[model samples]
Target: MSDIIRRDPRAEWIARNRLHPLHAAMQPVQHSWMGPNGVIRKNVHGVGFIGPNGIKRIDRSGAQQGGAAKRTAAVEVQLPLHQVAAPAFYINVVPDMVGGRLSSHDRDLLGLARQLAGSDGAVLAVVFGEHKENAFATAGVDRLLVLDGHEFDGYSPEQRVQGLRAVDNQFNPRHWLLPDSRSGGGELGRRFAASLKERPATRVWQIKGDECIGRAGAGQEDLARPLPRLILAAVECADPVSETRHEVLPLELSTALARSLPRIEDLGAVAVDPAAIPMAEAEFIFSGGNGVKDWALFHQTAASLGATEGASRVAVDDGFMARDRQVGASGTWVTARVYVAVGISGAIQHLQGIGACDKVVAINLDPGCDMIKRADLSVIGESAAILQALIVAVEAYRNGAKRDAA
Candidate 1:
């Protein structure tokens, strides 16, 4: 056998998996152990090889030493910490957190806030009610303010605006940024701006020095103007802060918010059919591919899960799905919150299409496929069997929900 060591995807995956039960046991045995002086002793010479990229990568997984178990490392880089002890000013952001988490649009808005905040200024996130987000540190939040009260809950825009007004009175942020999307940000930002009697720059996508550029005329043209204190930014405003972690310091309103009579009534959410939802707008998508042998089973599984149906380019070309249902570079570029691929091999175009997706779940027979690699979670199994199991699970969950409600 050739002496050149090869990459082990499965081993690397397991090694990186903190939740894996066998992860600790799979660690590589170093050449040197601990000394009597309570210090770690390692081979001073070297323990890894230099690759073609001219970088030294440590492969602790014993593949190089003919051992079945080893850990592979390519100099894992930790993000630098960005801190502000005493903020000179605040950059307020209201994210369109649809499912109580930071969406990609929210991250991009935070990145914009970071750029505006620069060195001395701080990014203050204004959240209303309860949220399940825990990655605000990595998402570039310097300060976090949660207006958690029953009055601010539900579709109470007046109450939310009152909370923002309170934040405005206290922090007096230099600039207020919010996502200009349908997920509450757009309306809330507009309402806040109107309440403050400030003309906010809407549909803003880029920040060029002292000016802002936004798409106008139904996104057919660009409109440039002086930067406003309040801005309703579009997606891709700026690349999200990736090279640094920030302190998410908690903050509260020093004074109680002034209550106002609500004009809009809270009637709660209404359920809609998934099939009517567009691919680009769908939060959860169940997509099928060529590997899917039973088309009926795929459709049934999608319906059981109440997910919008999608298909790979091959499936669309083969007439198994409509052209509008195709997902790829050649088709619709989806940004679904949850994208589940059933039997897709993960073509480059397909990967590019789902690049903005928050979570990807791949179910395929081939473990080494590109889709499996890109997926945050993967299930390697027969498509027909997996679909059947999924349907059963979904039914059980639905029945349980009904019983509890009853």
Candidate 2:
């Protein structure tokens, strides 16, 4: 028995940490279910279990357990007061050029900052472009710093970083927050974090008390922690109620700061198809998976429904779709009102990307697939047959509505 015992390299490390062998070896398993014709099919992780009827069910226990552990650890781990540089929270607010107003997302950030500040700490709102002071003041900001000029007119990542740097130099704020807008705030916050040699939390959709939760780098795992040095938050669509008034502090634009930053000539904006809206902003999405047969029909149906087109990582990897349209952990994160998954068997990474979506509708051949189990509505059938039927139904509905109006 002693001669047959296998030597584990991690045994010494596990013993030193006082961890059980089972705990060290407990890795998440990729679960599969019986598909049509008795074929076994693998779905996303954390969504597979054996049912009493011999059919497999989605088991989210692994994800739930991991999340619970992380949250518990976050709550229990208390950093010393000496480690904290300051108690205040800083927020970067970018103006909405198209809307010609302060982005409401800024208000959400302000709300988060206020919550983090509590009674003792302060919340500072940094603004770019020409905006009325009252706009931010009414959003519960404690203080406002304005940086307005021609250089700051359009979205310039460099100028934003420099402006943020100036504020950091003056205030040395410990906590920084920015809206996770792709074209604006997201880029600014990520660049700012890189400049400071600090890791930034990006696309964060939820904040619980003092803790911030979001996807870790590479979209591998859910990360939750107390306020960090910097955060790029994905502001929810709903408006936050404001209670605190703010004091506006207008600052003169520093010509030296502008000149020091590399000035790149603004070429006219590149024209893109209006239909190809960023997945982040799309309220309705039609996503395709490996099982989709007619790519042309998929695009046509999505266009007909006025929905943004998206794809699974497998489809993108197989060159069936563009990488930008890939919706998964390693790809882009989408927070759509309605997400339609056609032929997609949900993977854990893909599920994480669309976790915040209001409703999910999955159409797959396999009834026991992960997407079918997790989706709000599931249609089990062949992709081509369902795609054509859905298109015809949409067209008929439109025609009927038109006749009724007439």
Candidate 3:
């Protein structure tokens, strides 16, 4: 008879670590939650659900078929210290869909490692489920923890909290970063923080650091900790040039910020000199689009006009322009005296942001495009070539004006 195979001691230890302790030595986490009353209340030693501002509910009064709306809110999740063993970063990977096939969600989360590996020491990334190995490899992360089980698959409100508790026991990360999405990603972070003793700041849109402080609940003092470990959600948008813009920008932002905290003006994360909503004071504006392919000509057109250079989302996404120059639905909404659309197709999304402009001129090869229909003056021809001609005409007109002024 073959000798009974003795199980390896190491294998038994590994299996044991995977299972819950036979006797529950329950230690609860303490944190705060923004209750339904719109006030910060304590939720001690419970699951964390980091929520953004606003209430989500069904609108039965609306006649429109779609009765859903996305609301924005403040970040107000907190937690206690004892509940957590170490700091953790919550990482959620969402797949992109093109022609019914799964693709990367703009490769946004690839900067996970760099973003977390700051002065705070070793940070952990906890993924929701399975993804391609290469999905994280680009972020310079070698091994990623995949939290997949019967419980994690069904991620309802109650399930998310339980799963997070289980995860907290396993791999504790110093911080949590998720996408600013409608999913329970933010909520889970809030809930998890509530279960801890120390409070974690919520939201990514407004970075709550020494420079900018967060407003805690009523009666709660502005508790300042050494850049209190954060829980955040981020989104990656379209780049004008390629599919690789979002993946690259985050890494750059994270690295730069880590080296030196970026000021509000230089980083472009916060608003700067936003135009008056109804009527902007500016008399002239020069705009460029993704079609203004060559940057040289784009800048030349703006220089000749002596107008501020504005960019479309496409241009900003490609890293050619900064977020401050972006003018679109997701970027800046400007209402200037004269708005020029150079090589712009005038997509509805772009038009909505600038429709308030007084006088609009469109220069493009295709007059059939939507931008031509909306423009007060349509210059038909290639943007670069036509702009060259217009530059001389404008220069002469300006010279005539200057002589008259004299």
lDDT of 1 by residue, 1-406 (tens): 8999899999899876645655544555334433222224333224553422245556554655655233334345565788999999999999988788999889989989999999999999999889999999988999999988898777888898888888999988899999998888999989998899999999998898999999899887889999999999988787677667898999998998776678889999889999899888999999999999999999999988889999999999999999999998789888898999998988767877887788899999877666886799999999999899889988899999999999
Better of 2 and 3 by lDDT: 2
Q: Report, for every candidate in turn, its global Cα lDDT versus the true structure.
A: 0.84, 0.67, 0.48
TM-scores of the candidates are 0.81, 0.44, 0.32
lDDT of 2: 0.67
**lDDT tens digits, residue span 1-406, model 3:** 8899977775556434413331112211225433222334332212333322122222232223322121113232322121122324433232221222222222333343234443233323345444443333333232344444433343344544555555555445445454433344556656666776556554332233332233345425443334454444333221111111112111111111112222222222343233332223344677788678678877776777667777778877888777777776677666565788887877656776674465689888875566776798999887768877878898899999999999
RMSD of each: 11.0, 15.6, 26.7
Worst 10 residues of 2 by lDDT: 76-85
Clashing pairs in 1: 60-71, 61-70, 61-71, 62-70
| Model 3 accuracy (lDDT, Cα) | 0.48
Best by lDDT: 1
lDDT of 2 by residue, 1-406 (tens): 4678677777555543413533323433546533211224343223454432245454333444555334224432221121113434444344332234444456556666666666656666676776643555555555556776677766577877888787788776767887777546777778888999998777675677667778666656668887577888765522342333454444443444544555666676785563668887786899999989899999989877878899999999999998999997678877676899998878778886776565799999876566875798998898888888988999999999999999
Give me the runs in candidate 2 sitting further than 4 Å from their true place.
Answer: 1-98, 132-134, 207-211, 216-221, 237-239, 247-258, 261-263, 278-406
What local lDDT does model 1 show for residue 391?
A: 90
Q: What is the TM-score (0 to 1) of candidate 3? A: 0.32
